[model samples]
Target: MTYETILLAKENGVATITLNRPPMNPLNSQLFKELGHAVDEIAEDNSIKVLIITGSGSKAFAAGADVSEMAYLSPVEVYNFNMGSRKTFDKIENLGKPVIAAIAGITFGGGCELALACDFRFAAENVKIAFPETGLGIIPGGGGTVRLPRLIGVGRAKELIYGGEMIDAVTAEKLGIVTKVVAVDVLMEEAQNYAAKLAVRPSVAMKMAKESIQAGVNLDSSSALNYENQCFITAFASEDAKEGLGAFLEKRKPNYTGK
Candidate 1:
């Protein structure tokens, strides 16, 4: 299907999905539905090994869901809105392929939630981001209350979510909200550089590692180890593993087929 709100490009086993809504780039319900479908397209394409998400303009990654749209929602409409967000967020979090969020400018509320859903995040030096849900007489229902706390800590997450204030990129990196930061001029380049490198890695191993880490986070030590062992076995069973080891012994680069 043709997408008016986003752009998708794939090359060298990397797919870049750019949110194209202009001005403040608000995340409306339609955008959420399109995002879910786009992410699924990227995930199902076996030739794509890495996915990078970013904004089309330099002004805002996404300022949040269009607040104007939320002005007159009933309880059922609110439920539907949050459910769409959760569905799209799950698309990111559960993707077998690694997804990197490239935040260049303002990212708040649902946008923050979207970035958090990705496996990795790279932001510009002075980029601004926050939750700001509490200030609107509601709470972060798009997994911000849950995911933010997991990334940073309960204390810091609570403080940010409670105060409804923005944080700079450096602070976000320190708080674990972002993995790295660069200048605004080179933010997308830097993020794409990292993503390109990841694209060449063993896709099977990356998928296994992601699963292991995700499972480990919500389980006890013993249960986590069991999950890791299962992932380890799965990784070893892949064609990439055999090629990687044999190529290593032969002093050559291993080619993976994502088998």
Candidate 2:
């Protein structure tokens, strides 16, 4: 499908989605809606093993939601917008597969939240990340309040959100916001290399592991273990599990069909 605000492509078992509104791609309503559509497509397609999301240009991942779009929104409209973005982020978070955010430039406000939604993140040394919503007399409405704390802990999340301060990729990695920070020239190479490795693993185990971890986040100790056990047992019934055991006994590599 043709997209006005984004670019979508599939290659090397990876689906790459780029936010194309250059010069600090501000998230206008149209861009947000188009993002929803693009994300939905990636989620529904079975051929996509891993999803990589990033922004065009080297200046910004996304500046923030377009301020022009914000000025006229009623309180209810704002509420609806939050719900939409939350739903979209949730889809990526619980996509039943892998999604990685390749943060190349600036990641602020909605952009930071979007990256947080991904299962993993890779940032370049040139990248900057923050939740500066409070600077605008607002708050991070797109799961930043919920997910950021989960990713990087409450104290640090509060500092960034409340202070409206930006952190470079090095600090972000220290805080666990980004898994790795590399040079800009190797950003895509590193991200794709990771994706390629993930694609060859047991797909069923990966899916179940993702669900177990995400669902366990909100559950108690016993419940979390129970959920984890269920995922493990389910995998035992999969063909991939048989292949894995057989290959182990044969002292050979296992080939998974994603079954």
Top-lDDT structure, candidate number: 1
Ten-residue region with minimum lDDT total, candidate 2: 27-36
Write model 2 residue lDDT over 1-259, tens digit each, in one string: 5699888889967888888999898877777777778878876776777888888987888877777877788999878777777777787888877998988888899898889999889999999888888887889888899998988889988999999998999999999999999999889889999999987888789889999999999999999999999999998889999999999999999988878
Report the error of model 1 at residue 35, Å: 0.5
Please report the TM-score between candidate 2 and the true structure.
0.96
What C-alpha lDDT, on a 0 to 100 scale, does residue 51 get in candidate 2? Answer: 89
**Model 2 scores what on Cα lDDT?**
0.87
> What residue runs in model 2 are displaced by over 4 Å at the alpha carbon?
none
Score every model by TM-score.
0.97, 0.96
Best by TM-score: 1
Clashes of 1: 0
